[model samples]
Target: MAKVRALDPSKTASSLDTPTDLKPDGVAAVSKALNALLADTFALYLKTKNFHWHVSGPHFRDYHLLLDEQADQIFSTTDDIAERVRKIGGTTLRSIGQIASLQRVVDNNAEFVPPVEMLRELMNDNKAFTANLRKAHELCDKHDDVATASLIENWIDATERRTWFLFEASRAGDNSGH
Candidate 1:
């Protein structure tokens, strides 16, 4: 029940930017794909931020720092993705309204969650994002956009690995107790 500060977007980037090589039609597809990515990334950003703000339990200190790092990384990447959208001749979605309306990632209320529950929820969200990234990369590849595909693929892999690590941490020691 404390005040939470939102990240200032201007400090993150000066303007939207897209790849210069994309053709018009391909740029259109990339634009739409980036829009989808922007939404997903924003949702994940908020989720991580919420976790950072509200997480508590035995793992409070560790999870607190972890969630903060996750939120920072997601915020940076989301800005990059949105800028890429603009570089490809499209505009990045700017409001929570656009993100909430377009994002596929599920948002959870993090007003009061135990640390374990927060980790579980974030693990699930990361898995969902990994899947979404793969699907978007496939579409990018279809448009012969190997650059975008590579970029998304790398992120998907990282997210999947991070989810696995979080999942394992959440499940650790529980078996010994029960």
Candidate 2:
């Protein structure tokens, strides 16, 4: 097998942007949309993990495992989203502050959110994510970027599935110390 080389430092400069056929404006629009999506994904992942760690009550094990699984799924998309930006000759987010600025998902800082409430909130977040994914897919279509649209389609389905699970989990089973 041939040895692979890392990114050439000089060639990775901003002036030497990755080549793409998409219009410059299209790249900018899609990159901006994708970065926002990425930021929301990160926020959702962290909130899922937070709920996973803090969840209490009788059904702790099931809720914890579900959240862990969902968090993993949410995190798996970040690299793809960010790399798609670079592939389109655009930059991706570089800092937590940037993520916070772009993220639309609301943060949860409550000292104690009831377990059932947590499920409801996560479900809503997933629903919002699905909506955002649809919007991104539409933007990608406008830009004639089928590759990113395909990825967004998959993410939309996954997010809807997560929302469904959360809905079921929180539907009626838990008491939340009532």
Candidate 3:
């Protein structure tokens, strides 16, 4: 196996010189919020994909498909977020360790978790993610970064929908024979 090299954060300061009309402080604040959002997104994406792959039960197909779709949606936002950071004259996350350090979402690495438990966990996570997005949106509004705020608004709606679906899926009812 080839030896892996660690990323040097200092060497990757390309966004430092990028010009933007926004105040530097505002840019910095929004960038920080976006980084946190990106980190949580990355963590959630991994967790969702893990559940997608590991889910095994009577509702395996439904659970797997839902997770897969949600993971894709989460992964898709990462690029837009990173680019927005750069667009606003701020640097973005550079490594997995950086992302892990900034992330607020908890990772679930258990070999086995009940389907209901998984759904409940993801539902809660999605809700938490929406909260983070709202906080970021507020920062954007404070800074008058309308572009970032708009993006965050869309993300908030998407996350809320995901949470609703997970909540409904996790409900114990006659259909589930629970």
Candidate 4:
């Protein structure tokens, strides 16, 4: 068996090293864009989870399950976003306050809201997120960060699909048949 080495307790946070071929300015720009995306993702995840827990009406089960699944997908992106920041030699969000400060998504703490309204709000938020992702993807492209741009492309497609589903689900009737 190989011997295990102990971690050096003397190492400080600033001592962490991130080596990359990308310039410092490019890294900073990409990291800033990714941080904004991360913040929005976290905010959206919380809002979706809140809706999941509070949702009610004739479609309670369907809405609750949809929100839960959507929340999980949003949460899944946070780690990747943060990791991308670090990979590019920059830091990421550190606290709830930091995330709240950076986030653009609006919070809903109302005691009650109509289920249709909730669905509409989330659909709009997802659309906004996709817009933000597109902006970030452009930044990545500007910086020539192919990896991050590719990831954002996938995210954009996924968000568009979410928006489509929500729009369809919120429709009042089978208008497509007309």
Q: State which candidate has the highest TM-score.
A: 2
CA shift of 5, model 1, Å: 43
User: Over the stretch 44-149, how does candidate 1's per-residue lDDT look in tens digits?
Assistant: 8888888888877777788888888878878878767876676555777978898888998888874587777778888998988888888888888877778778
TM-score of each: 0.81, 0.89, 0.88, 0.88
> How does model 3 fare in lDDT?
0.88
Worst 10 residues of 2 by lDDT: 1-10
Best by lDDT: 2
lDDT of each: 0.77, 0.91, 0.88, 0.85
Report the number of clashing residue pairs per model.
4, 0, 0, 0
Off by over 4 Å in 1: 1-23, 176-178
Q: Report the lDDT of model 3 for residue 178.
A: 45
Model with the higher TM-score, candidate 2 or 3: 2
Error of 1 at 13 (Å): 24
Model 1, residue 113: displacement in angstroms?
Answer: 2.0
Given candidate 4, what's the lDDT at residue 92?
A: 94
Q: Residue pairs in steric clash, candidate 1?
A: 17-83, 17-87, 18-87, 18-88
Cα lDDT of model 2 by residue, 1-178, tens digit: 2232234577655663786778788899999999999999999999999999999988899999999999999999999999999998899999999999999999999999999899999999999889899999999999899999998999998999999999889965654633
